[model samples]
Target: MYFYNLLSKLKYIFTLVITTPYYGWIIFLQIISGFFSIAGIPMLIPVLEYIRTDISGAEKQGHMGFFNYVFSFIGVRPSFYSVLIVSSVLILLGQILVFVSTTIAQFAQIKLSGEYRKKLFNSYLAVDWLWLTRDKSGEMNHAIIREVELASVAHLNSQRIVIYLTQLMVFLALSIKLSFKVTMLAFVIYGFLIIINAKNTSYVQSLSENFNETFKRLSTLTANILQNKKFFKSSIAYKGFVSKVFHCIDQTMHTAKILNIREQLQISWTFLVTFTFLICLIMSHRILRVGFSELLVVLLVFQRLSPQFSSLFENYLALNKNIPIHQSITHRLNDIKKNKELCGDEIYQFNKSITFKEVGFRYPEGKRVINNINLEIKPCQTVAFVGTSGAGKSTILDLILCLLKPARGTIFYGEISHDRLDIFAFRKEVAYVSQ
Candidate 1:
């Protein structure tokens, strides 16, 4: 089950990366930068060893094969200053690549958010009125604003996870070269820690989902209040509406507080475990009979690995939290596509008169608004529907304007049936004034 969930999360990350433009370039840059960053850490070990040796010594005491190979490759003699310069150069190059990659990733994130927002907006515009009316305007706004932003952040975090994983692999490889047993021990300890915290990760995901629901409710409530503030304030229901808003806000805040506490606890626990591991490495050096230089390198590697582990866990939790938002957006887009307004090819032209022959209309909720209505009006003729508010006056107008299709019978533009006429082109001939 755990492995299946892990694969699912990985697939989500892969889909997100693949959908974004220039993501290939971003991953490539991240890999190169991660290599440089972890590769530079091991250089410090050789440089430290070179510095500890006598300046005029004919040979070094510790293993210098790695440095010797690097120096030979660069056609430079193995000296303290030479190794130090190369180490600094490698670290600097890593930082430079990191800066470049981060800049591009950030740009990609912004572009992605904009593209998603635009796509969602276009979907809203293209969707039929029936589906649009069924959805809350506030929830749609929240998806376009908050949900998209969170999704973009999730994408960025996924990229960071990639970079961190790459660096961790490099660290592991170097640590193994220095001291295989210690490296394996550290790996096992960290893996155990992850297993221990798996439940917390799942709990955080639940809290995130709860928070999303509460916040969306809050957004919808506030939007409703804003839209009808005058009516709400003048009516006796003002207190009730206000109380509901406050309740939603409280629920949202409560969920957020718990989520933050869980995250902090995870961080604290990770730190405690990492500190204990570091202490064990220091104290067991004698028992392991590990050489000073190799032990120091292993320590350095583990020290860096600790934070990478912590970051990976943090990002994983965040990714899980935001996955629902992405899923919601996908579902929304699919619904919009499914509910797209119907269109026809033939252009509508007004000639002679408009006629409704035994036309009937009813809403989806079984509201029979119009029934068997026969109507006709010539071009340039002014007509008024005289009926009470709940009557089918507006429904008849909508049928004429092609905003609503008839449930039975046929409406015609001159001799052409409404179904054969392009609704958009038909609307072009209409000049409506709404109250």
Candidate 2:
């Protein structure tokens, strides 16, 4: 079950990535940047070896076999200064790549968020009036605004995950080249760390879900209160309404607090475990009897490796937390698509009269508003519907405007049925004034 869920989440993320503009370019930049970032690790060995030989007053020879071959191939003699300069160049190039990639990614994030918001807003406009009325305005607002923002964040995090994973793989490969046993041990430690944090990851996802729901509720409550401020202020139930708002705010804060605490715990636990592993590595150095320079290089590799591992794990957690937000936005978008208003292609034209033939209408879950009604008005004629509150006057207007379809019978414009007429063209002919 867990595997299936994971696969589904992955597929969703992939879909999001592919749909995003410039995603291919961004990924290409990230891959190249990852390679540049780790290209300096192996150079450390030769540079350190040269420094050691210089300090000991020993002859500096190209003892780094692989690096020597590489230097030769590049038409550069393996020397302390040469290797140092090349390593510095590689690191500088990596930083430049990082900067370029980050700039592009930030631009992409903004563009993606804007696109999603526009898409969602347009979908809301196109959806059936009944469904739109049934949906909470504040919830829709939150989805268009906050949820889309989180989706952008998720996209950025996924990109960072790619970069981190690449760096981690390179670090592991380099570490293995230096010391296979130590590299394997480090891999095992990382695996154990993942196992230890599995529960925390799940808990974080739950908190994320709760956090999203509470915030959405808070938004809805706030919007409702603001929209009906006059009624709430003039009525005796104002305190109750205010309390509900406060309760929603409190729930949102509480969920955020727990989520933050979990994040802190994850960071602290990773640090402690990795620090312990570092200390053990240091303490076992003498027992292992490895050469001083080689051991130093190995320690350097592990030093870099530890943070990459931690970052990769944290990225995974962040990605997991965002899954629910993505799912919520996606589900809402799908619902909007499903409820999209239906219309015919024929243009509506009124030549003589607007007529109703036994027209009837009702709320989806309420008593009939109008039934067995027949009426007509010629062109340029004015009609007034008089009724008490909850009467079908507004409903009748909506039906005449073709905003709401009748439950029974037919409405016509000079003998043409309402459903057969194009709603947009019909609406263009209407000039409505409403209270």
Q: What count of clashes does model 2 give?
A: 0
Deviation in Å, model 1, residue 254 alpha carbon: 1.2
Error of 2 at 376 (Å): 2.0
Q: Any runs in candidate 2 off by more than 4 Å, and if so which?
A: 55-62, 350-352
Write model 1 residue lDDT over 23-83, tens digit each, in one string. 7887787678767766677767766666665435235514466668777887998666776
- Per-residue CA lDDT of model 2 for 331-374, tens digit only, reads 89899999988887777566678899999988899789899899
TM-score of each: 0.93, 0.92
Error of 2 at 364 (Å): 1.5
The C-alpha lDDT values of all candidates are 0.80, 0.80
Which pairs clash inside model 2?
none
Q: State how far residue 120 of model 2 sits from its true place (Å).
A: 1.7
Model 1 regions lying over 4 Å from their true place:
55-58, 66-70, 428-431
